[model samples]
Target: MPGVTDNRKSVLITGCSPGGIGNSLAREFHQSNLRVLATARDAANIADLAELGIETLSLVVDDLESVKACFADVETRLGDKGLDYLWPKYVNNVEDTKYYTVPAMEVEISEVRKTFETNLFAVITMCQTFLPLLIKAKGTIVQVGSVAGIIPYVFGSVYNASKAALHSFSDTLRVELAPFGVHVTTIVTGGVQSRIARTQRTLLPNSMYTPIESEYSRRVTHSQHNAMPHDAYARSVVAQVLYGPAPWRWLWPWAKGRKAWIWEGHRSWLIWFLLARGRPIAAAFKAATGPSVQSRLAMQQKRNLSIHEYLSARLLKTYGIGVPNGEVARSGEEAEAVAKSIGNDDMVIKAQVLAGGRGKGHFDNGLKGGVRVIYSPTEAKMFANQMIGHKLITKQTGAAGRDCNSVLICERKFARREFYLAILMDRALQTPIIVSSSQGGMDIEAVAKENPEAITTTPIDINTGVTDEIARTIAIDLGFSEQCIEEAKTTIQNLYKVFMERDATQIEINPLSETSDHQVLAMDAKLGFDENAEFRQKEVFSWRDHSQEDADELDGDIGCLVNGAGLAMATMDIIKLNGGSPANFLDVGGGATPAAIKSAFELITSDPKVSAIFVNIFGGIVRCDAIAQGLINVVQEMGLRTPIVARLQGTNMEQAHKLINESGLKIFSMEDLQNAAEKSVQFSKVVKMAREIDVGVEFTLDI
Candidate 1:
């Protein structure tokens, strides 16, 4: 133990391992002229810090006795001068999906307890043990928490819960420690650059989790690469923590950082909804031995209900909602027959896929759009033949698109007036809110953004439901004609009944059309049911079109195949901000192998709408050259013609750039993010212009 030397400002940081957050912060604080005491589980682990004149100590923070002894030694050394800062920033994460995917009752109690011991109890103990020293100096306590705590994800329940508990503790500590002139601040960080890619352990094999391990692991791999660089992260964190006039909570320092994604509630909710609905959470935990675990699991598992237009239309019909007469046809002959059976009236044939923007999508076999309005049975048969058994790509379908296994032949009805209407649960109000706009089609979100006044939002009380008063108010807000008010009210009531009875999360009728005859029709219906209610609503769950989804897909024009969800989204937003449309959201992940990269390359290039592709890689555990090689292999094998703009950073960056350059392919490299994005946009525009000039869409095809 070192004895008290000078009165310089001091900071004691636990878990100062190399390539870790604590170590980075220690360096940052030391550079700021603070007397730094960096502690780790093993003194030898942080021996390098001593070279920089930092005092190092071996302290197993999770063990109470170790914590006490460490504090005692510190007390003996520092004396009454005490400690100016105490950062309890240690953490333990269980990456094994099995630990969380298993029924809570089935998971070994010891495992969960151990995680809490390190992530939660130990932090609390360290604070308790060091309180006297901190109080004497009126020091600030910085607790580094994670966003995972605030928004828990699957396979991270235990770790997320522990951090959540710690967050609560930090809040309480801030209040309790205030009277002593002591400050407590919580830094809720998102993915920050660290050695996470190297340190993340593989899932330990258990019969319960082995089968689904690969799937979940692939799902989380990109998060590691999406982390903020440690130097930048540490500097940002320390600046906030050390600056005078401390607040109870620290906002994310860099506006461009990953933390912004957490507060974008709608975006985050969409991600969660997609993940929850796509997987069978109920089946994953069916082996749980306890009834409570099973029951709770059942309740939460019924999220992410998948329903296409046909299924949704059928659901509406059940509630007496007016829908165009339609019948499912699996083949062109079937579609023609269906058309003939309906007496050859103008008809709309729509591809039966689970994605949006079908009107603007096309099939690979020269079929234009998922929806086609035709006056003849021959045209219906031709469109059906082109769509059925062909891949249909839309802005939402990514490059690969989805198989058109069926088509819906519905009578085409023209609307004299169109309006957008939807009922959805409002998180802020904790109630069902009805959103309606006089103008509608596929761009309701855009209308809501640009002309919010046109969009009326009415919050409904659960007890009153959609009463006559509420219906009249909604109809008036929608500018419904006096003659149409009663009919509109009836439609609203039926929709509300469907929403309540089916436990639906969202009911949208875009362009709830008014025909020339003045009849209201559910022209296009989209319904999302509460996934948790699937057990009770078996009929709704049965309609899930799993084929419409890939392992991952996000809507955009410029395809993004980055490594982490946060980074992937950031890239997409940046593209949009830079006047570019993202073609799809594709995360190859942190540990993507050469083969995976090749697959990703092929997938992105296959999309006709994806004029250009952007590949942003922050190689942490993944070597940059491996990614370059994958790109090269795909270009050589498939002769990819799409323009590619890549930004490669991190491990073996030089080699990665070299490999791509030497390949002599039509790939452009830019290490800077903005530069790469601009190039991708320019190239995408070029692709668009060139295709317009020539009927046969083609690029230079050479690097």
Candidate 2:
């Protein structure tokens, strides 16, 4: 029962079906002289376990009913021995034969259900059922999460999101169950020698008919076939699992080895976030020389513009640099009062909290001081009165900071170039990557496009400081003349120094333009550090924006809960595509808490201009039963008359869908993203027809 004191004990793993990662792990553990019990959804699946001289049992991670029954069986078999360790190698990205593939439009609700049953729901049920045993064992519970969780592919968003959710859930579980002696470890593998590579290859049917797809199919298939061997990935997993102590998360196959397809996902996200934001990421997909998947996805990966504001204006202001006139005040009284005190005839008033809303002219949360242009104190008062405790919600603020207390008041400064600059951790280079550009302020991508050579990157050795030489070069290239180069170099160097010293994950400065006064000022800035590295950088980490966070991420909607970044990203994508831009990305796909859903709706509605909504729920671990109950209760209380198009799929969907249909709420069942997107736009138009595609759901106004 003692934890980590003895490694020579029994370990139980679920979903040890033949020729799978679980089966391989079971063999390795057995070979290591550990008592290994390998389980599967059915006993028939693990007949190979008997041949390997390991104990086998019937188990299902998805169904609580089946999981409970299996746990009872496991308890009877390994009582007191108590399963010294537990591993879930269940469902290695569904094995794709012909059945897994069909026309994209032909995807069935059942297929969606099949995916979650293995990837998300079952895992939850299994964990709960085994909690007592794992507690008794005082051992580790390892979840096999994926690199796809961090990245997204055109067709694979669902799988990627499920994995992402697992990663997030693992983090929460590790924190919550830490006091109970349960050690939770999540292994985020990049690529490995597994049948999954084969399965992924099969997900796309590469014939000449889809010429663009055929070529991409070949490239992806070859890359996957050559992925690192499964055994190698397994050894990494086993070593970490058995190494006595472990961290909450480990990216085993780092970025250097990842397929370009995956790497592009992560980079594009950061890129779009840096570049064009008020617009949908789909603008990036406008490239011609790409596959349908890439074309579809490129169209959706637009920047999260609010983030740019934080980069240039907010973070820079912290470094003792002058930003175009802006002031931070806590209350509307303070805001209006500050405007009067500043004596500026024209100033921008914004919610000062770490949220975005000022630009939208909504009840802004002051996240990054949601800034708004105002003529006088009266204007400030009008904005403040409306914003006070009114929930300045947005795509990222979630439901918590809707009513903003803090506001940023400042004189508007005229400037040019919506360019970007940032210091971020680069796992590949094992150092910080400095990204700065003469282009991309409001539109980083456009900036990049107009001036491809303008964006300059320098990798700094964390061991030493960023040299004046590198900083000077970057500044000079970014259009800083000789006079400003010294100051610019020093500034760039200091930013890197701060990045390393502060253990920052990201520190962005957007529109690093020359002040109208001819001095350099960061128009916006945002700083983020590694949570794990927080211990070393207390002061920096202490500046946590608990509310401004991508709630879609914390809530597991960051594609993991929703099953695809496309879905996750497209929620934002469709809104913008339909002429009704999204306030933020709220994914209610994974196991969404009722509170999370409520927050999502609240955040979406915070922008009055978001006249309509698209609630696309492709149920995974989140049951239709739970979603229906949650929606009915939450929406009624919110008092929203805005037309809401609800698309629910997965478990108990029929019943839940029926409930919504009869609820007398403004809800419509549209099957595709296209229909939903058009419906969302239409609502904004004449306000007619509620309907929706799944890669980027179909966009049709013909409804």
Candidate 3:
């Protein structure tokens, strides 16, 4: 085996595209004093590596001939030294929803074949070609597996299966090559921040997946939140491979806890196959049962769902469901007054917080509990005082507890029986499901864990609202008496109404109690509305709390203002690709107003780190001309001197360009997003250099 030496160490990584793992790893390895050869399908893609003393090569892993030629080239370059590390990181990810979400039978065979050709076949070929080199050096072979292979989430079957195959290959390779002293390590990657998530959308067969394309897109965008930054992920992997001498089989740098939970939850194929096969058949059955009835429930004219408890109560009342007659108190004094209004009856003073497990929580100032049973107004005031000003920590709240700014003082009532009633969107069924159980209260999750069969679920089609017959059946199944049947049925019907009207993703009444008076009352409820439907739910949208957001976002240097989440992410990535780090991600949303755009600008510029701004808008609902006007308004009013690059496309883009060009502002309005990104980076560099020069001149003057 070749001994470790700074000059002797060499690493070759394939698929070194800009903003990719290979590119990042190559750069980092070079910085660590290792000879780095960054290869891609096109050498031109990695041309920039020459500046950093990293060699670039055109190596197509998919082509067997290309793989052989690449090996020959590596051997010739390294001469008798032998290769230290050979990373064949060529990955092809197809974004077709069917490949991930649909049944394997539904996915096109061509797509599967194409994916395996790159991800599996190419990988195997590369490993065989490089085994000799790695054996010579006693180096590590890092196989980049994914969490998808471990969990195999719904709609990601093909990709998951491909990764699973790769993982198996790596394991087998490890055992076979152990005697050769070539170590094989599988990096089970969590979500890594990359342009692939954004750019891969275009590669999806949107026309073919007409039924679920929008949902697929939403899921793709939603998943990016947990993605580890590419550079950070690369650094960790490179460190483990280069510095760590121990034979570590798996390196998990992201979603450690999540991965563990997923592994535990992963079940057998019997349930999976049944569910996958039944989806379309079930949809067809549901459609046949109804005469294409439209929903009678009124849609929210304005606003979106924000705070769970308060909004839930309001929506429950609106739908005529019985709830405790109480209001949210922002202070201890207000809580006291509300307690008084309950006329000294037994009142439950509950700290209003976004997190759950509040009943088992404690306040920061040595307060024992978040919930307290109070007899007098004074008692309510005392508990409120302890909670409202202090942070309430629970199992869900972590160590840094959320601030309890408000409390709910509600009239407490005794119940003969508690029932759990919940309507939640089932992603697999693509419909809302009513989950009801005779046993309810705080231990509902326990019931689910220990006795899942006790809960009855009824999936409802969105087109057809919950029928009276369906409601009666569910109510009866929940052990409701004949007398309470009408009441329970009414509450269930009303709950569906509220869910439809508010565009709620989930409406959970944990303890829907049957009071002594035979009334079905919502004792505790949690309502969560779909954020995508926020535009229609104006009231709910207005309830958005910005305080819960990250402080760094409010203060970043290269502020990004984009329409869609994917576009915003892509813009930020491109900015970074061009050597400029984004300070904030400020998405003005699709139907953004000129006023909203102006507010976005002000918010982004508020961050002292922001010396440059990049705006990439694909105007679908929003016109580009309107966006231009908004930018012009901000620049003129604020006299903004920050270098701005705006890339406008779709929907009156020509008009937008014309308007921006004639605005007399120094903003660069470009037709191409790449050009805009490059311009922003150049301008940011100039700004930084100018600042440094000014400081230099000031120092000389002082001397």
lDDT of 2 by residue, 1-703 (tens): 2233334577888868777777778887776678777888787778887777787877767667777887887777765656667776547545433222333344566665666567777677777878898888766777754445433333454555556676667667765565465657665433455444344443335444365665345333322422444455555456435531111011112322223222222222322442222222223212210111111222333223123232335565566666766666666677778788878887776665554334543443342335667889888877776665666655444455454555667776666334467776533233466777776456544543345456555666666668878888888888876677787787787777667665566677766766545566666666555556656756554555444444332121111123345455535544443455444555554667688888777766655445466677756567776787788888799986666777666556778877877787776656565576667666654432221111222232222
Point out the higher-scoring one by lDDT: 1 or 3: 1
Assess the local accuracy of residue 591 in candidate 1 as a C-alpha lDDT between 0 and 100.
79
Clashes per candidate (backbone, < 3 Å): 15, 73, 18
Candidate 3: list runs displaced more than 4 Å: 1-304, 308-311, 443-445, 532-536, 539-703
Report the C-alpha displacement of residue 267, candidate 2, in angstroms.
Answer: 15
Q: Candidate 1 local accuracy as lDDT?
A: 0.70
TM, every model: 0.44, 0.39, 0.43
Alpha-carbon deviation at 345 in model 1, angstroms = 2.4
lDDT for 608 (candidate 2): 41
Ranking of all candidate structures by their TM-score, best first: 1, 3, 2
lDDT of 3 by residue, 1-703 (tens): 1223336578889878787777888887887778888898888878778778788888988889998998988877777676777787746443333344444545688878876776788889998998788888766677664535322444556766777787677767755665465656654333466443443342245455557666455444323443567776676556545532111111112412323222221111111222222221112112112111111001111222446486578768887899987878887799889988878568898888876778988888988888788888888888888888789888656688888888888888888788988886653234577878788875564564456567766767677779899999998999877899988999999999988888876677879998887878899987767768877988877776554322352223677888755456456656765667778656787876788878988888777677778888766567778878877888899888887888877556789988988877777788766678877777777777777677421110000
Clashes of 3: 18
Model-by-model lDDT, in order? Answer: 0.70, 0.57, 0.67
Which structure among the candidates has the greatest lDDT?
Answer: 1
